[model samples]
Target: MIEIKRLKFSYGETPILNIDELLIPYGEDCLFLGNSGSGKTTLLHILAGLIKPMEGEVILAEENITNLKTHEMDDFRGRNIGLIFQKHHLVHALSVIENLLLAQYLGGLPKDLNRIYQALDDVNVLHRKKAKVYELSQGEAQRVSIARAMLNKPKIILADEPTSSLDDENCERVIELLQYQAEKYDATMVITTHDQRIKKRFENSITLR
Candidate 1:
């Protein structure tokens, strides 16, 4: 769960995000709708503890971690949050399984081979476990990223326009995997997107004007 109040942020005196108040509870999937420059990414970064807000508090899992040191924030974010980006940020040289294993190791999570394999299996990429990251198609690589995000079994999942590039079928696959993992982990999911395809799946959506 996440709670924010009077959160304000700026880039060199120019305000980019000014969230009045927001609350997301467990077992919830939310769609955040915003146009270009509507501060969607800014807000998501704040939630992910990637930026320090000029004002307000970020409370996650009962920790009012408004002032955690950068290293602490990084560790917390790694273990607690899973992020899915539109472009799969995979290392081209590593094999599919290696990329996922690296993330788990970076987060200092337990390196359970079965868990890793199960994650890949969930994304329907278990067979590609030995394939190099660059060998995957866009859709396959996206699944690899999804696998990496869920590799640590994070309690919160944040995705940025995950379905924007794919066809409808692939889009469905993308969304379905996210929702399924959210349920599997009982994680709160907050997705930022301009795409309308995910609107129906979210019970509630926040629109930025």
Candidate 2:
């Protein structure tokens, strides 16, 4: 679950986000709709603890992340949050399974091969586990990214502009995959995008100015 209160973020003298209060309950899926420059991604970063707000609190699963120390926040984020960015961010040279192993190592979690395989299997990418990231098609790469994000069984999944570059079919497929993985793990899903193709997909949503 997530809660934010009096949240405000700015860059230099300009304000980016000024949310008063927001909440998303456990296992819920929410969409953040916004035009370009509307701060949808900024809000997502704040929720993920990747950026600090100028004032207010971002509480995730009962802990106020805004107050956590750098290392503490890093540990909490790695353990509790999964991030899927517009870019896959996979190491092109590494195989799909190797990329996942690296994620676990970077998160300071033990390398659980079985968990990696399960995640890949859930995303329907198990057969491509040994292929290099650069060798995958766009859809396959995206699925691999989802697999890596879910490998840790995070409590919240934050996806930023996930379907922005896809065609209609791939867009729907990605959304379905995201929902499936989130439900499978019982993780709250929050996606930020300006894509109208998915506007009606989520019942819980908010639009940013």
lDDT of each: 0.89, 0.92
Query: TM-score for every candidate vs. truth?
Result: 0.96, 0.97
Candidate 1 lDDT over 63-158, as tens digits, reads 676788988988998898899998999988789989988999888888888998999999999999999987899999999899999999888899
Q: What is the lDDT of residue 57 in candidate 2?
A: 96
Q: Lowest summed lDDT over 10 consecutive residues: which window, candidate 1?
A: 58-67
Candidate 1, 37: how far from true, in Å?
0.3
**Top candidate by TM-score:** 2
Q: Candidate 1 — which residues are off by over 4 angstroms?
A: none
lDDT of 1 at 77: 82
- lDDT value, candidate 2, whole model: 0.92
